[model samples]
Target: MSIRHCYLQALALSTLLLFSGLSLALEKPIGPAVLRISGLVTQPNMLQQAVFDMQMLQALPQHSFTTQTPWYPEPVKFTGPLLRHVLAAAGSAGENITAIALNDYRTEIPFSDALKYELIVAILMNGQPMPVREKGPLFLVYPFDSQAELQAATFYNRSAWQLRALQIK
Candidate 1:
């Protein structure tokens, strides 16, 4: 096979996959689900809602940032996918989101916040998986250190720990 021929074949296959909607597929979670997103989402084969295991969240583009939070005494590095990326994967250009915690705490966040800030659904803290007692499994955190305005009461209140679900609207 000629190199040019192989290149042409590869391009054709990729174009076919893209047009067939294979490029937009989101697989069913194989591990235990850690989070659920519903209301206004358009995930493949699961329009209106999506379940995400730890690995599913990790599969998105990952980002990390260190910030001092009121919940902690020192600045700690938080690592996970950006909230915007998660929303994109769910096919939601959301306007409002209700973040639900494991203990039933709920907070309303404007979707614009995700677009404006480096908000993250944090899976790891300080290079280690956060324990439940330490506010883990999952946490929605803002990049407080990145901007002075983010180090405020409003952002802290929106930073829901033990985050379990996000209801987009």
Candidate 2:
């Protein structure tokens, strides 16, 4: 067999394996999907959308930070996976994200925010699970205390609560 033939065969096998792995990486949610990410995603598990159960989100690297918000009387500790990590799991490659809450309130968050700060999709506040009435099962919590500029109204608006879905743009 020629060396050229061997090289071509190896390349073909690697390409096939890569594509197979990508499909296998997407798993259906076992429990009710708490979060749904659609549009501009490479990996979609449920009806061509990326859906996550609470356990799935908890499996990712955890990030915690304390920050004061207008919604709360005092500084609260927020804990969950970083937004960028969640986006990566969805295979999202977009410039913007339209975060929609359960109440239908929506906000546009630049993708750069995820990259620039340790913005968390918070599942816990002050070491306790937050129910829907408390602004979660999920909340997009910015590290407001980390940067002075993040304390502004624009950033506050971006900190969406009761987050249900994200539409990548």
Candidate 3:
């Protein structure tokens, strides 16, 4: 990709996030709502939470990476929209985020991690949608193999699978 293309993409994203932060009204989910993001956000579809379905998540720009993770037997390709973009769409402002999994597991992650790393809310694993048994509808993943720092347990713990909700603070 050319520098000009990158510049244009950045410009478009900046304008979208900045101008729509306050006025973005999320539409009712067309499919089953899969994720809820609440707390410290400028825009919320519900009282304090913004719910999203698969279609909503897929609407954002998608990114993918193949990485070796502790849970997987081999390097697997994961794909989803960048976590930062999702937060930006929600008009989120926070120092931290609490990820809640389907089984009630939760973990705290610094907000800076999203900006600092190419973290993704993975909806696909190995180019296919993951089943709940395999860590499903959503997974907060870090590109562990991309950087030595990401290989640590701190980052691994942040890679919450079967993710259901996020509370930003």
Candidate 4:
């Protein structure tokens, strides 16, 4: 073949290969149990503990507390991992995290509260897994009974239930 034709053919092949690799690298993976909401998971960092599936949250050492809230008639028993642990897992270090629930309910939580309190992303209630109707899968809960300061209207509004995504900002 002519040298010019060969050179052009090689250049086109290289361009195709480079573009193909880029596309493959950007493709996301899907699994039965785990969901990749956004970004990529690198080495297990401080924030690895921050993100959890329903099963993973249940498997971890459970923390339970009875708390009274306007939503319920009686004090409720909440069970889940401390919010800080989850934030640590996600390697999050921000002033606020915008939480989005399954039903698209969204709220922003201050990082200070997560660091100071035993706020948790709860998957179970009263020893039973919560369903969507019952606010299941995940719920951002604060130890309202432990600290009267957390029982205010503002904190109650930030407690997002059936949480699906948390974007740090």
* lDDT, candidate 2, 35-146, per-residue tens: 9999867678887799999988888778899999989889999999888777777776566889999999999998778768889999999999999999999999899999
Task: Look at candidate 2 and tell me the lDDT of residue 33.
Answer: 89
The regions of model 2 sitting more than 4 angstroms off are 1-24
Stretches off by above 4 angstroms in model 1 are 1-23, 44-47
lDDT for each residue of candidate 3 in 61-94, tens digit (9 for 90 to 100): 8999999999978999999988988887776756
Top TM-score hit? 3
Residue pairs in clash, model 1: none
Error of 4 at 16 (Å): 46
Across 1-169, the per-residue lDDT of candidate 1 in tens digits comes to 4568545534443454455344356678899889889986667435457888998988877899999999889999999988877766665554589999999999999977977899999999999998899999899999999999998999999999999999987
Angstrom error of the Cα, residue 85, model 1: value is 0.6
Q: Write the per-residue lDDT of candidate 4 for residues 115-148, one digit (tens) a residue.
A: 6788888877887888878886677888888987
Judging by lDDT, tell me the better candidate of 2 and 4.
Answer: 2
Off by over 4 Å in 4: 1-51
* Cα-based TM-score, every candidate: 0.84, 0.85, 0.86, 0.70
Q: How close is candidate 3 to the true structure, as a TM-score?
A: 0.86
